[model samples]
Target: MTGGEVAGLIAAIAFLILAVGIAIFVLRVAAVTKEVKQTVSEVNKTLDVVNSEMGGLTHEVEGLLVKANTLLNDVNGKVATIDPVFTAVGELGESVSALNNSTRNLVTRVSGGVVNTTKATVVARAGQKAYAMFKKNKTEQPTK
Candidate 1:
């Protein structure tokens, strides 16, 4: 072949090779894009489901909070209603304590005083009887 024809043939073969390479790159890129789109779609669906579940849970938690508040209020109201009764019980306890203290003091003083006084009386009476017996013996012994 001539030099010009040979050069032209080489150029054409190079072009063909370049076209095939470009085609392969494009196909690979397209396949990767398709896979990414499918993954994104699945993520979006999962997100939707999670959102729905969270929304339901939030509503349930709100309901529980409301019930708890209501129960607390009811308990507070009952406590308020019985406040006077508690006060009366406290006053009764105080009165009982006062009475107990008074009784204890009185019993201690009275019992101690009675025991001491009785002992003193018994000693005095014994001395008087002994003196009377001595006088009788002296009068009966002699006139001298």
Candidate 2:
């Protein structure tokens, strides 16, 4: 063979080797890009699920707050209702105290009056009996 033909054959073999290396590099880059795209998609899906869970949790918290407010209002209303009852009980206690004082005074007056009248009658009867006894003793001793 001629020297020029031999040089041309060596150059063609080197070009083929370079082309194969470039093709392998491109294929490896494509595979890495595909993996990156899949990872991003999975991240987006996870974010969507997290957002939905957060929304549910927010709704539950709102419901619990409403229930707490309602319970507090009910307790306040019951306390308001009992306020009047407590005042009425206090008034009833005062009335009972007044009635007891009046009853005690009335009973004391009645019993004191009855006792005075009985003492006066007993004193008067005792004086009359003593006078009759003195007259009888004088009559029995006068014959001498």
Candidate 3:
């Protein structure tokens, strides 16, 4: 063959090889793109399921909060009803303490020598007179 013909043949062979290489690269890229598309579809499905579950969980949490509020209100109402009883008990305790203090003070005053000798003598004479009168009346009564 002539030199020009030989050069043309070599150029044609190189072009053919380059075209084949590009075809193989395109095929690999298409396969990778298909796999990526499938992965994205699966991810979307998973996200949808998670969203549905979250909605149900939120609803249950709302119900639980409502129940907790009701229970708290009930407890508060009961405490309110019992508050007067506790207050009355506290007042009763104070009253008892005051009575005890008065008794103690009276006893202390009586035993602490605050009563003078003259007053004591007068009290003793009055007690004797009252006893004598009681005995006289008892003896005067007729027995049936």
For TM-score, the strongest prediction is 1
Instruction: Report the CA-based lDDT of candidate 2 relative to the real structure.
Output: 0.70
Model 1 TM-score? 0.55
lDDT (Cα, tens digit) per residue for candidate 2, span 1-144: 899999999999999999999999999999999999999999999999999999999999999999998997787678557655555554554455455556656767978542223443444445445445544554564341
Q: Could you tell me the C-alpha RMSD of candidate 1 in Å?
A: 28.4
Question: For candidate 1, what is the lDDT?
Answer: 0.70
Model 2 clashes, total count = 0
Give the TM-score (vs. native) of candidate 2: 0.41
TM-score, per-candidate, Cα-based: 0.55, 0.41, 0.52
Those runs of model 1 whose alpha carbons end farther than 4 Å from true positions after fitting are: 1-29, 113-144
lDDT of 1 by residue, 43-139 (tens): 9999999999999999999999999989977876785576555555545545555555566568778786422234333444444454455445545
RMSD of 2: 31.2
What ranges in model 3 sit over 4 Å off? 1-39, 113-144
Candidate 1 weakest ten by summed lDDT? 113-122
Using lDDT as the measure, name the better of candidate 1 and candidate 2.
Answer: 1
lDDT (C-alpha, whole model) for all candidates: 0.70, 0.70, 0.72
